[model samples]
Target: MDLVLLAIVVGIGVGIVVGALGAGGGILAVPVLVFLLGMPVHSATASSLVIVLITALASLPHHARRKNVDWRNGLVFAGVSVVGAVVGSRLSALVPSQLLLTLFGVMLVAVAVAMLRRALRTRAEERAEAEQALAEDSAAHDPAAHDPAGQEDAEPVATHDDPVLDQPGPDMVDGADGIRHHHGEPEVPLSPAAPAAPRLPLVIGAATLTGFLTGFFGVGGGFIVVPMLVIALGLAMRRASGTSLLVMVVATAASLLARVGTEVQVDWVTTLIFAAGSAVGGMLGGPLSAKARPSTLTLAFSALLGGVAAVTLVQTLLG
Candidate 1:
């Protein structure tokens, strides 16, 4: 097959993977080009960068339209990621690209396993909490028990809807006599925790490292980016996905700029054609993402992560 034709085909595949899984382009792009098409890793990495940049660009306007970019947070992480990518890209020229892929493959597998563990743990916790809530509700509803002074207090931790209280709620316990039985009545004060913006620094650190790997190895960071955002940064799946695409858009652009004068090869024409396909595909993706159920998304994401892990494990051992 012609190299440009091959690249365009791969680009469409990468775009669909990105649209569906939110990250997997470079991993798919590199291995296919290397083993199947016999492209050298170095050239493949450069070519993968082209594919990544184009797909990322294609995905960006959709995310921007959805208002998930969080530019301030994106800027901080993107700045760090750009630096890391430049360093990683420069290093890519010195070290063997094959070695980078092998290392990256391991990293990808490790992240997938970690996320699977976290997802299981989170689901368990949510279930346990729900069960406890049900038990509590049953106890509180008992007709024989006295709820004097509404002592059977049902306190809900403040959410986005209500103002957070500075001081604890009145610390008086309910009395059996339907009133404060005595002056020394003890009340369990509700603990108030501060709500933080989801875009935290530690999460950004993960994003930066993912970008470095993506830019350095020519893989999409979606596997790492989406899970980290959902599990660590507490972003919803759609938001994490949208945010990941934006970050990719920034990181890929920066790396491409660095590679412009380098010895790395890029088929810009092929890359553009692939991106043209992705633009239409991605327009359809954003709305689908918004409509998908969270549970369905999580399960689907878990399956995708499992696949990536299996691919990485096979590739790493083979390499």
Candidate 2:
């Protein structure tokens, strides 16, 4: 009974991470099951898949309600990733348990370092934007700063050659229904000029890699998917996070199905209890994440991953 309670508590924590960040469910779950619940590595990895699948599915509705999901793109990415997931699951059976744990530790460290670098970059960008805003404000006050040529009385010339000015205004967006909508307004038919297409090849390559990682490590692959959606598909961080959940649901399901015939045994009782707790946590985290700053959350999560990785490495190598 006590162990079941502990599992619930741990699952909630893992689910909160997955729900809020759109990743980390399996990364955290595998270690917790092995070290805390005394489950074997193989069993833990398989069980982690269940926890991730449940959490992602539970959290997805909240993001969808906020219009954060891009259904068409997410489905395409998931479909391509299924092949990679099957291949990776087959390869995972060949690797030894100790080696897999060690590799998982190394991957955690790499992800932590990458996240730290991204946080630092975001901070620098924010600082640069603030400085630029200050400079613009100062120039507005001192007309001479912006009008060095001293042509204040001359009529300003409108230049159509500057493509930046021709772009859609901030509030305009192409909705899923093939209409353009102004912020908080009714949708209208889109203009004949359409947005540029996303990079299909890059997206496919990233999805395949994400699937391989999910199957091999029992991770949700949201860390990779979120970044791919943001950089390759031109989604904002919040939208990318929501969209990544949709991808994770498919990726985890594919990986789990591939393991069906394997000899590895899963403790269904513990797995279901953990999943139940995660489902509740997912409900809370989705709303909380929508209110929090992405940079702050990313830095905190990276630190947590670093600590977990250190502990896992020490225990695996020395004990």
Candidate 3:
């Protein structure tokens, strides 16, 4: 009963991280299970996958309702990633547990650094935009700034036959019959043009790499997937976070399926309880995430990843 309670508490924390950032559940879960729960590294990794799978699945509806999930691109990325997941799962078994954990720690540190840099860049961009807006607003209210030549004080010279008014405006063009026509106005409204397709090679490469990491380290791969969706697919941060969850569902499922007959022993009872707590946390996190600034979340999450990585590395080295 005590262990079960602890699992639930841990799950909720992990779930919140996963839901808010659209990743980090598995990254956090594996180490927690190994260090706190005293589970073997292999079992912890396998169990972490289950926890991430459930949390991602649970949080997906919230993002979907917000129209954040890019279904077409997500599906394509997931489909290609499945193949990589299968291959990675097969390779995971041959690697020793110590080396795997070491690699995980190193990967976490690298991801943390990358996220920190991105957060700083986003903050700078936001600050610049705010300054520009403020300047524009000030200029709009200042009459003198707009009329440095003092043209506003000059009297208006109106004429009955103003040549300027008779001339065609920027939107007007002379027709073949020498009649001026409004080129901007159409007889009928045209449908909006379709969005340009994402770069295929980049999508494929990113998906494959994410899938491999998911299967090998029992991660959801959302850390990588979210960035790929944003940079390669041109999705907004919120939408990319949501779409990453969709990709994680598929990747985690594939990785888990590949381990079906493996020797990895999972604590199903504990896993289920943890997943239940995570589901509830995910529900709360979705709305909270919508309210928070993306750069703030990124910076906070990166700090978390760095702390976890440092601890994991220290523990492994001591052992």
Taking the candidates one at a time, how many backbone clashes does each contain? 2, 0, 0
Off by over 4 Å in 2: 134-195
- Which has the better TM-score: candidate 1, or candidate 3? 3
Candidate 3: tens digits of C-alpha lDDT, residues 37-98: 88888888788888889999999999999877889888888999998898888788778999
Clash pairs detected, candidate 1: 26-219, 26-220
C-alpha RMSD in Å of predicted model 1 compared with the true structure: 9.0
- Please provide, for model 2 over 49-91, each residue's C-alpha lDDT reduced to its tens digit, 9 standing for 90 to 100: 8889999999999999987788888888898889888888878
Candidate 1, residues 1-319: lDDT per residue as tens digits? 4766765565565566576545666766666666655667777777777776667667767767765555655555566678767766767777766566677667656665665665566556556656776877787778644557666574542211001111221222245543321123322233335233454666667767876786688766776776666555544455567777777777777776777667877555644665565554555555565565444444555566567656655765675
Error of 3 at 207 (Å): 0.1
lDDT of each: 0.60, 0.81, 0.81
Please report, as a residue range, the 10-residue window in candidate 2 with the lowest summed lDDT.
Answer: 157-166
Provide the global lDDT of candidate 1 against the true structure: 0.60
